[model samples]
Target chain A: MATLELRGVRKTYGTGEVVKGVDLSIKDREFVVFVGPSGCGKSTLLRMIAGLEEISAGELLIDGVRANEIPPDERELAMVFQSYALYPHMTVAGNMGFALKMAGKPKAEIAAKVAQAARILQLEALLDRRPKMLSGGQRQRVAIGRAIVRNPKCFLFDEPLSNLDAALRVQMRTEIAKLHQELEATMVYVTHDQVEAMTMADRIVVLNGGRVEQVGAPLELYRNPASKFVAGFIGSPRMNMLEVAVAGHDGAAVRLTLPGGESLAVPARDALVKTGARVTLGLRPESLNLADDGALRGKVEVVEHLGAEMLVHVRTPQDDLLIIKAPDEARIHPNQTVGIGINPARSCLFGEDGLALILRVDALA
Target chain B: MAGGTKVGGRREGRGWPLLSPAVIVLGIWSVVPLAMTLWYSTRYYNLLDPGRHFFVGLRNYDLLFSDPGSLTAIANSIILVASVLVISLIVGTALALLLNAEFPGRGAARLFAISPFFVMPPVAALIWKNLLLNPLNGLLGWMMGLFGLPVIPWFSTAPMVALIIIVSWEWIPFATLILLTALQSLDSSQIEAARMDGAGPLARLRYIILPHLGRPVAIVVMMETIFLLSIFAEILTTTSGGPGDATTTLTFLVYIRALLDFNVGGASAAGVLAIVLANIVGLFLMRSVARSLNR
Candidate 1:
């Protein structure tokens, strides 16, 4: 129901600028997740949007209204904190009904709203219990229920699921996605877990070192990253990077010599390719496969079986280790010589700068 | 079969021997004086008439209770403890909240705020008696004179008020120290969440900070009551229970019977009454504290 716009929003403390000039526009009902490594200011950016932190410079607009000076509660936005920050002295019903009480709502309205939220979060029987009596997952649900009772214009989550166990993290992840579908409210989520970002967000904003690296759909960022940082951050079993030199150019592609004396010609901008210039080649683990008479030859160092897929770590003759994702049933073992094939069209090339040189192309192109 | 059946109380009989040293020390320290006081309270023993020690079965208590001054002294004790407790708590909580805020020189300010507690009781009374409330050339008199107002004698005119002020000045620092420590442990995220929930400053204090300080405030009340109930030094130094029993409390009444009147049996009777009164107050206070803590 609200569109959030941050125009050159920067946060500076003393002399250190933590969130340096971020500009983003979140459309109404869009689930936007800010994904970054720790200390990349993703949480700080979310706090600024929540009005919990002051925007030192630049403007923040909510639904086309200037909201930088508005207080958090006045902004009509609810935030779920990582710590679950429930009032330990209050009962679950009391905790969920606090915001409504503060707004001077009638007692009956507050009770009804809290009841509805407790039902939505499946916490009917635990209303009288305090936070200390509940498990971690229940506390997390109470935090979300507290926010849900507010029925805010947007929802801001600051790594809410990061504190749960792995199994519970996945469960809460899907529950939050389902909640978003049911509410149709704008959500700005922040997490270091790219998997959560990939699964929950309609659009992902990748941040690194206090700057937005790229913003796009999940598959779009996967297929066409804007820079080396985004490619390394957005995927699990990170994209492999190798230092290569430009061997030649073929019309719209750049030819490069990879490790183990294998040559790869990846489609990149021809204008940025220079003969004999040093470049970086980005290859996802799935882009490399085991094949007979493959270009790149290596010795398998380790094979990891992951039920449906196995990751084979291959050591090239030059001591360069590369990982290849293969079917779990593939007969791969340690200390075996293998030839690894590369998919040229799916590969990425970077010049001296870490900016990706590949243009967005069809997956089968 | 006996060992198996005796499952709970003193099953091994080994704990008492290990715990005897402290028990013996405490028995000699407390039980002996209490027993002697009880014995003396029932006997007609006077230091002036040493040869006339005889059993008098509640006669001393009856005489002491019949005196109207004894009633006044009891009321004075209650008034002093109650007023000091109220003043110290309200002022101490305000000071604690102020000191908890982040400001330059806060460490130095906190050190100064709790410095009055470090001064011994008699010394604090002496300072207040001579320098501050002294009416004749004291700092307060000088300040009043500067405003072209007549100096009002504090000890002679309002002796009980003077005593309460000096005692509260000493105990407020203690309340602040405990309450500030409690305030410091309050989670910052809780405050931020309340702010996000639209609680203003006063609401935050009412709903969050005060409830967070409930246990510490109870401790302060119990401890201050224990000490303030037996307040003697400030009364002795400034008012000496003076201006015709205006500031006389139960403890001073006991002192008067024993030392000033040479009536050992009567003083012992008053002392026993004081102990009973303290236990009664302590029983109620402990029950309330236990209930709050359980909640």
Candidate 2:
């Protein structure tokens, strides 16, 4: 295993800079995942590390040696692409042993290694079948097997499970995580799906607009996102933001009036702003519930029941449509008035510039 | 489905009647001539002796097969087809590979490489014979004189070789275009995988690229075989059944037998035999080269 370091890595096309100065150090055997939205330089950084794309400026060190000038073949790293990219003409055994064969391994040795790998992957029965004859999951396994046979120092995965159906994606994602544990190899995976990043990564690197926003443990980012972008991008159904103005100010606590003119106490003590300064209160859907005698009031626009849970969409008097997760038995109907109590301890606050406000949360008494 | 099939069949049948005039004309022009040739191939009638003839039981074929002139023609035909196929596949595939690479002025280079295929065969041969490879007056001859070397006879002693060059000039362009198209469709990811697997350029070519090209290579062989076997104009213009009959291919041999030897029946027999041989070769190539069936 090798510790990979991308030192001041920058990528540009023509005159436009895409990945602007990204510096990341992936420890050996670390399952680091680069997570981002589309056009965010996650895949671009992965390609640079794989040597598929040229590093316009900066150094890549693998195991403490410069690897910028080296071609992908000599990098001692394997990649599993989104398309699988299996050699269609070859049998499963041949596909697995191709790298060994190319390395001039003896026929007997190649045979032995291929068999061992097949047994490991539980693909012994399919050794003679071509990739086209295999199912989507089988093909993906073969793609993994092809890389596994090489025994590279590291593995780079570019949205490897993106092509599978939703159910299969979860299954394959677990398999890949187990494979990483069994192999104990350094892997830097790239994906736009935060679920994949959260579930599979030892450390998740959230990138946006060609820059690293934050890198931390899955729960670390979930519990305390450093910025508004990271906070909104990490969770499903997304976080709701209501524009608010500070009505009254305390030392560490501020009384803010939400868009509906309903006041709530928020913890935000950085860059002391005058009264009436605008801000956005970040509230996750999961934190809102139909509590008795709640303060924020709105009319129920729609309620979406997903068998296990219900999603209540309430439009407040200020025209701020908010969605809150409710229990399956909760009664919510269209055009009916609804009030939601957001768990103040779990919500976040941000200034007008989208910088998350760190605070010791307390209510203004 | 039944109604759709019935309507399609009725429409096709109606279209057939519409095509009757062209079909009838082609039958009279082509089919009747082919039938006449078949009839003539089995007869003993010569053009000088009118229509009366006895049915020859493969006597003319035996005579033609046993003759030295016709044997020389058969040998030259085989040599010419072999030499043309080998040279074209090698040169065309090389040119195609070079064209497939990223280089400056690649579009111009490709157009230049396939230009000879569009040139008329007679003009190509004449250009080669007079100014390119001619012993006394060609470009090579002139270059040799610049080096103060004696001019060597290229067309006479090595007329078969010269014929090969001219025919390859015509066929290589077609082969190169087909190979280029095939090469372009090959996925770059597989190549990268092979490379990441530590496969050098040659190993990648041998294991991955060559196996991938099975279908296209088969196509090249089949197409080139059909076109090269019937080489006539190049042999006619350059060699003219040449000194010692070194370049008299099957088609040219058939031509001379009818025109010069005044043997219509024998020529028609040779023509029928050539066609049968081509069909047999076509079938053989098709049978051996299986489909790739790649996903």
Q: Could you give candidate 2's per-residue lDDT for residues A113-146 as a string of tens digits? A: 8887787778999999989899998899888888
Chain B TM-score of predicted candidate 2 relative to the true chain B: 0.87
lDDT of 1 by residue, A16-57 (tens): 999999999999999999999999999999999988899999
Candidate whose TM-score is highest: 1
DockQ (Cα-based) per candidate?
A: 0.71, 0.66
Candidate 1, residue A311: Cα displacement in angstroms equals: 2.4
What class would a CAPRI assessor give candidate 1's docking?
medium
lDDT of 1 at B49: 90
As for candidate 1, its clashing pairs are none
Residue-level lDDT tens digits of model 1 in B81-138: 9999999999999999999999999999999999999998889999999999888868
Worst 10 residues of 2 chain A by lDDT: A356-365
TM-score of each: 0.95, 0.91
